[model samples]
Structures are given as structure tokens and as C-alpha cells.
Target: MANNFGRVVEVMVSNMLFSMDKYAIEGTIPFDNDLLPNESEIKLWNLSKDTISRIKRNETLMINAGYRGDVGVILHGFVSSVLTKREGVDAVTSIHVLDSQDLSKRKVKDITYAEGTLASYILKQMVGQLGLPIAQFELNQDYRYEEGYTASGEVTDIIGKVAKDCGTSAYINKGKVYIRNLRRGADDVFALSKGTGLIGSSEPFEEEKFKGYRIKSQLQYRITTASVVDLKCKDFEGRVHVRSGTHTFSRTGDFMTDVEAILP
Candidate 1:
């Protein structure tokens, strides 16, 4: 098991920032940012009455967590709901958030593209309509519609279509949109070994005919969805593509990232 001491967590609600490690008596954040709109929850206990009162729906929420000197933002989304309940002598608040707001459910009116329009251009226009900032926008193949094309339906569906046509994939991370080649992973590649935070032996897995492993490591922000991780261990020694995962932190000594990945 990794040392994983000195846990740190920061929560920003709109302009208010709370150092969870100090202010919160207990909390846990579970996030899975993958294809489709990402949704997660933040639960904190024993927050000050002032802070809890100030939190409201639709406010921007950003969470960062890791060990000391290794922290990074793990989730960025808008508050969907906030509920507080009295448990024993503590007040526990559960805040639900959704990434990209309502963009995934928003319907895109029918838009026609003339022949010779690049697939990337269409994706850009659609994403622009959603008003979210773009982090990375690159496609493996920018297909040109020689016969023109029409786009309609949920914004996410159209994005999926464009990705399929261009042999790419689309997802939202930290409130930013990304459309990239299916075979390619994120820019940072993390190496995992016993010395590098690998928690235990990875278990082999096969899903949809794609073989990979289910891995757990000390909680950190570097291994997110679409991240590339090189595994060096007794059972596995190779690079795997992160498909989906959750970063969890709690006061009960449960700080880890559980990942589902595939060989790529």
C-alpha cells in the first residue's frame, strides 16, 4: 500500500473557498469524468453555519485533492442541489453537481452544413453554442462531407456523431470540452509502480472484448478519465488507457482513485 499521508482537499463554491482538510470534519468526493456529461457529489460534515448558508444551487464548485504538494483540481461543475441534515451532533451537507451544466441535455436545433465542410468545424460551432470553454479540440480525422450533413438532437449526441465520423471521442473534463482521437490518451502519461503509489495488485478485466485491468492507487488528480498510465508491477507491465474512474477522499482513511482502463 502507498503511504498516502498528508491528505489535502479544497472546495471552492463560487467565490468562497474552504480548505476541507482544516474546516471540514469529514467529507468524500467521488467523480467519474468520462464520455457524456459528468456528474458527481460532494459530501462534507460539520461545516460552519455561515459557509453552509452561503452555498446555493447553480453556484460554480471546484474541488482539488491529493497528498501534500501533489494536489490538483479533480472536479469542476455547477451545483445542482444542496441538502443538509443533522446527524448526531454534526451537520452534514450533500451537494450534487453536474459538469457542463445542462449542455448535455440541451437540444440542438437542426443545422445544415454545406458540402466540403470539415467535421472539426461543425464540432467547433456546436460546442460554441454551448458556451463552455474549450480545453483541447483535435480530431484524428477531420472528415469532409462531400454531400453535406445535418445535425440535430441533444448536443451530446451530435458531438458523439462527429466523433464517430472522425474516429475520435468526446468528453468533458473540469468543465472543458475535449474531442480527440480514440487511440490517443491525454498529454501526461503517469507511471505506476509500488514506489509510485500503486496500492495493490491490479486485477485483469475484459469488457466488450477489450482487455484491461482494474487498478487502485493513492488518491491523486493525475489519473483521470482518458489519462494514460504505464503500469510496472508483478502482474502487469505496460501502458493502459484510462476509460473511467473515481477519485475519493474521506476522513476515515479512505483516499484512493479506482480506475477502469484498457490496453491501447
Candidate 2:
């Protein structure tokens, strides 16, 4: 009803923000650690001669996006690939990005903890060894790492093992690592209404497939994985934590956030 879909997508390269309004077609940035790699894709309608020369593989990129004047960073990574295609009168360019964790997957490391090592300490040490950027971190009570847990593996794998032992969920968002209890009703940000932000009917949860409601909302709220949000519809009413979410924008000034939230 209201004109609540305006957005701005900014792309930074070589420490400068390029003029993207003219090139941005549509882009998707997914914040997920389980199903898909935390990555982003920007489809460009037209690529200028100078812009083409400035972009190169392995360069660091920072993608910032905002909706209705509320702006926050959504992604950080390095350029993985770029391709171009011709469509009649217009040329299209596509850019792929890989998150920091993707960079860490290149090497293997050994993990050895003496008897009775704290889980939080182990996590901190592992992250430091991997040289990953952390924007936020949380851990509840202390849990000891028992003896004979020595191993050598990818850093992400070790972190997941530690989270399981501590009875917490570990995830990375916008380059930050989180190890905390599962989110529930008390963590819900606000209620959803039909015209306000909810897009369509809520899909019932199916445990067999690990599926939840498919929701499309305005980039009006700060939604991320493991954060609880409330949804009320004719067939459903409850709070669910986001399992995965994607924020996307197009040059035509359209902005949307899609989420798959699950009941805790």
C-alpha cells in the first residue's frame, strides 16, 4: 500500500564506492552457513569500459544496502568470478562473491586440547588460527573439552563439533561468528501483518524436509539467522527463528528480504 520498497545498493572496490545505480540490475546476498555458502551475486545491466578495467578477480569487496533510509552492511568478501553476456541491445555482467569462511576452507589445521579445556576458549583459539573476521560472538556457560578429542580438520568443522558439545548453535552472519542458545518466542522482534511486511500465506512447518514458512518482507526489519520473528496468519500463529535469509535489490529500485524461519 505505502511506497515502502525503495532501496540503494552500494558496491565498493579498491577502497572506493563505484557509481552502481547505472549498472545494478538485480542482486542476491544470502546469509547462510548450512545449506549454501554465504555468497552474493550482482547482475549488471551494462558495464562501462572503465568499470570493466577496474574490476579484477581476488579483489576485496564490501556490499552495503539500505531500504527506506535504514542502511546496514549486508556482505563482505572477495570477488570469485565475473562473466558477461549480450542480450540484444544491452549487455549483462554477473559477479560472484565468496565469504571469509570460504577463504578459510583452503587449508587444514590440527586441534589439540588438554584435559578440561573450555569450549569458548577453544572456539576463540580456532577462529584466531583461521584468521577469520568476527563481528559478534556469544557463548553461555562453560563446557569442558574432554580428553581424546584431538583432531585435525577444517576450522568450520571443529567449530561445529564444539557447538554440538556445548548444546548451542554456531553460525556466521555478515562475517561474525555466533555460538549461543536457540532463539524462541521471547526473541521475536515484532508481529507480521498482511500489508505491513508479510507477502503471502505462511507455509506449514514440515519436519521431514526441515522446511518452514517461506516469507517475503520489506527490508524494514533487521532479520538474520537464529533471530526469532513472529508470524500470524489464518492457519498459523507463533514465533520462529530464521534458518536462512536473503536480501536482494534491483536497479529499478526494488528491494526485498526473503526468509525461511523455523519454530524452535
Candidate 3:
């Protein structure tokens, strides 16, 4: 009376999602960086001598990019946001360039198919952990499919939680993305970095660490249906001749509910 066909699909799809997300975070964090495979591209912000002395006495600071004059500079962190606000200028901006030799290129699905498939896999996993029956069937089969939508949308929404705790930009597009030791929802878009799928609002969170940043799970699950029924039958005492086979109980209505007893 046990059917594991559903479980087989569940495990396969869930494993796919989990591994893909894990790789997304791992791969992106170092892709834009020049470090080796085993290296980590993360660090806490170190303020300038002037900035530090000022913050010690004052509660805020202002920063401007053009103030560096003729040369470009890279500044990262929350302190930068506070400075941007104080400077009274736009804190973010972006411009997409065409590296494509063919401008006719376009997209109906994700520009990154693997990650999109990956997003679907992650979504399948999150809903599975929701402990809701019909969740998989509902989300996978019942939902409408809109190109450039849904699967990637859901994965981005949930991954946002982990990214928020990780204090990094958790985004996906094309084949590359980046992660850094960012402030809770800070983005590097203003630095000409394009970002999508940021971590969003959710329930209360806790402080824990994985790798280094504080971490918390946005997923939970439980069995939605489970039961056992007792079945009984009288023992048959007579043995029939092997050459003469006899009809047993009629096939119709002969089935019994499987019994599973848990003893103390």
C-alpha cells in the first residue's frame, strides 16, 4: 500500500534545487573576483583614517564619488549609503552595454537557462518544505508559465533571506553575479552593478553563522498526511492438491488496508 513514486520525484527535484542554489551562491561570490578557486572574496569594511576619526565624534558622514577628482575609487558598505544620503545625490545607477556581436539576440526565457532551471528546482524544494500537500503538483503543473517570470521570481524571493543574512548581493542574470559582505539589503547597483532578486521582507530572524555571515533558514516542512489502519483475516486450515488449483477470495473487494503498528 506504499507508493514511493512521489517521493522519488520529490527527492530528485529537491536535490537538484538545493545543489543549484548552493552553487549559485558559491559560484557568484567569486566569479567577479580574481581570486583562486579556494579563496574567499569577502571582508568587513575598513574605514579611512579621516572617516574613522569623524565617525568616532559624529554619528554620520557624507561621501561623494567625484570628490576623488581625476581617478576612480571603489568604496563599499553601509557607511557609504549614509554618506550618499548626506551628499544629496542619487545613490544608485546602471547602463547595459552590448558585448554581443549580434544585436538581434533576444530572450523569451531566462538568459541563463541553467540558473532558470535551477530556480525552478529551488522553488520546488522551498514549497516541498512548506509541509503542504498538493504544493508540488500545484506549483509545478497548475501554475501559469510566463516567460521571464515565475520560476526565477520565486527562487529570487526565497534566496533573498539567505542573502540578507549573508549581508551580500544575492542576484542572478546571465552566467555571472557577485556577493560581498554587504549591509542587510545594500546593493552595488550605483557602482554600475546590475542586480535583481534581492532578499526581501519576512518573519522575525535570528543571528547565527554559516561560513561567516549570520544565517537563518526561510524554509520549514512537515508531513501533511499520515495514517495506519488495522486489517484482520481468519486463517485457512485445509491444503488443496497441487494439480487442482482452487479459487481463493474473490478479487473484487479483497484488498485490505495495510496496518502499521508502533509499539511502545
In terms of lDDT, which candidate is strongest?
Answer: 1
Predicted candidate 3 versus true structure: per-residue lDDT over 207-238, tens digit per residue? 34311111111110110011111111122112
Return the TM-score for each candidate structure. 0.91, 0.83, 0.15
Q: Give the Å error, residue 211, model 1.
A: 1.9
Better of 1 and 3 by lDDT: 1
lDDT of each: 0.79, 0.69, 0.19
**22-41 per-residue lDDT for model 2 (tens digits):** 45557888875441257788
Tens-digit lDDT track of model 1 for 92-205: 888888865877567777799999999988999888877778788788889999999899888778877887798877888778888875348446889988888888799999
Indicate the TM-score of model 2.
Answer: 0.83
Compared with the true structure, the alpha-carbon lDDT of candidate 3 equals: 0.19
Which prediction has more favorable TM-score, 2 or 3?
2
On lDDT, the stronger of 2 and 3 is: 2
Candidate numbers sorted by TM-score from highest down: 1, 2, 3
Output the better candidate (1/3) by TM-score: 1
Report the Cα lDDT for candidate 2. 0.69
Best by TM-score: 1
